[model samples]
Target: MHQNPGGLSAAEIHTERKEQQRRRRNSLLLVVPILLFLFFAFVAPISSMLHRSIYNPTLVELIPDTINALSSWDRTGTPKPETLRTFSIELQQLAKQRESGRLASAVNRSYPGATSLINATARKLRNVDPNQLAQTGHLALLDTDPRWSETKLWQAIDRLGAKYRIDNYLTALDLERDAQGNIQKRQSSNIYIDLYSKTLSMSLIITLLCIALGYPVAYCLAHAPARIAGVLLVMVLLPFWTSFLVRTTAWIALLQTNGVINSVLQSVGIIHQPLELLYTPLATILAMTHILLPFMILPLYSVMKGIDPSHVKAALSLGSPPFSAFVRVYLPQTVPGLSAGSLLVFITAVGYYIIPALVGGTEGQMISNIIAYHMQQSNNWGLASALGSLLLAVIVILYWLYDRLVGASNLKLS
Candidate 1:
């Protein structure tokens, strides 16, 4: 064995390294469960959602032969008789599998009212033999349904037959691909952009309101005596104990036209008539601000509590005015807290679903509401996923901007 100047043998050094490696392996083993849980619970779902946004496999999976045949033909002219025969054969298989509805639904998403035409053709061809279908050409199929010759139907099929596409993302952005495979703005009323803008605007307003309301409360909590601060902290945390749904319902009851706020105002002779308060943008902003206020206060208070009062006092003793000392010396120290709290509140507000749904009327509904509508009501999971991905991208971009401008490293809880 080799010996070192410190009298450590090579074998002893090897054994020590092995021991360290063993400890590290054991430590890593302890965290494996957490890592697996995070991957399955968070990462897997997000990845699946993103994939769903771009994956369009229903048509290709059901009718591969038809799609393969159509791929060779120039899309400008009418589909040849051989292509029609191939599609008829595939339609027979699709009906045999009882998946005509699935294909029809998928096609209808691209071309409205296509489900009926496809279903009718499938029904007419259900019992026809494959040999008979081959013998009869495109003209016989056209006799069954004139739509068989229509370019729109074939184009819709070609559009829906892709295994993977960006149609969902384009639709989410209120855009579409033309027949020439060129991107174009949709002719329909564009609503997603409006909803997205509204979501961001409302979130910003709520963040500002939270900051305005939370800064003073946080200042008081941070500077108060121990007993007072403890009481104040409990008061701030009291909202957490209540359920979110319950709090939202309470706000609705208080903000309704004949609810507590209007009743109190009328009783005090402030207004002669009850004002409409429930189901408005004002109600949404107010409820969201209240719900998210504690988030802002807690972070601000944590950072402010650690600030040294002596620094501000020293500035005042140096003949600086109290307001100037505060603006110049003390305010700058709170930047970290402000950034942390504002980011927290803004992100949380952007994803809020329940409060807005309960209190927000037509004018106040947010993009999250639209996402939910597509997922649950319209049965448009692809569109929902695309919208969700877009929202996630926006958040990531905002975080990158915040990191660049405000320096995320400067953000602190305490």
Candidate 2:
């Protein structure tokens, strides 16, 4: 046989190394598109939304001097002469840039006296020496209106300077700021805390109802023979095959005073007249429970199926009562499924804007409907986004708490 080369050819070795490096680089390159896509799609939009929530432009850009001058003064009382000096400087700069309108609009957003202030300052500047204008004209201008020296105006300017503040968060909760920068409950007309409370309460109620209704059904399905369980599962899933809107509408027709339920009741002499069933909390709860029952059932069924039947028998043989056995053995085992189902149903219920809007009366409306109204009807993206972010934060905190509790329980069990 021909003798092989003792050492590899230099070209062959170089080619092999290069091939290996190319493969490694290609593997790294594969992640680039995915990262780029995520940034462009999800991160970019969310960042844009966060930016929009705190965005108030003209105060920071146009009136920096005012913000700085007010920084030294206490917000609880009337502002000093320095605050007036700052305003004069801001107005002069605005006049030079011909952007007085923008400055007016900014001030107008919070407190009154924007257009008159801007106009008066522009006119006053014409009579004073340009260099001495801020120092001299500022004091004289304040004498014209004592409201100019009031702390409320300075406080309003200060609010814009902080950029990121709890103001929007407080506002969403129907709280307002006083002249002293303290938050208090809003007037009855403006108060929306009730809506938030109602939304949370309704979600909890619906979740409880789902658990109560779905537990037995799920237990039966879990214990049945495989063939029987499959048939029952198909029946449970049949509602999902139909459009949600169609199902809701069908319920509306069925539950209406002149419709199937009331007609059947009246015919059977169950009541003197058709009960007011269509536009009440009862209707909303019943409809939501019907729709969400499957969410609870599926999770519990999955967990119950995974559980060995011998555990319950062992508990009974140990002299535990039937209910006690269930509480000690079966119930503890179903914690994971219960948690999963409750979280799913609760989160889903909290965001139920369309269902509540369509079926619920004034007293039954949730926070989501108000947020939607702000977004679509009023075009108040700031308020809408603030509310949405608050809701998201609340959900995240709840989930984190749930995870911690579950982890602790698992650790203890192990």
Can you give the TM-score per candidate against the true fold?
0.93, 0.72
lDDT of 2 by residue, 254-317 (tens): 8788989999999999988988877777777788888888999999999999999999999899
Instruction: Tell me the lDDT of model 2 at 223.
Output: 94
Residue 66 error for model 1, in Å? Answer: 1.2
Checking candidate 1 for backbone clashes, the offending pairs are none
- Once fitted onto the true fold, the runs of candidate 2 whose alpha carbons sit more than 4 angstroms away are 1-42, 58-165
| TM-score, cand. 1 | 0.93
Could you tell me which 10 consecutive residues in candidate 1 have the lowest summed lDDT? 405-414
- Cα displacement (Å) at residue 289, model 2: 2.0
Report, for all candidates in order, the number of backbone clashes: 0, 0
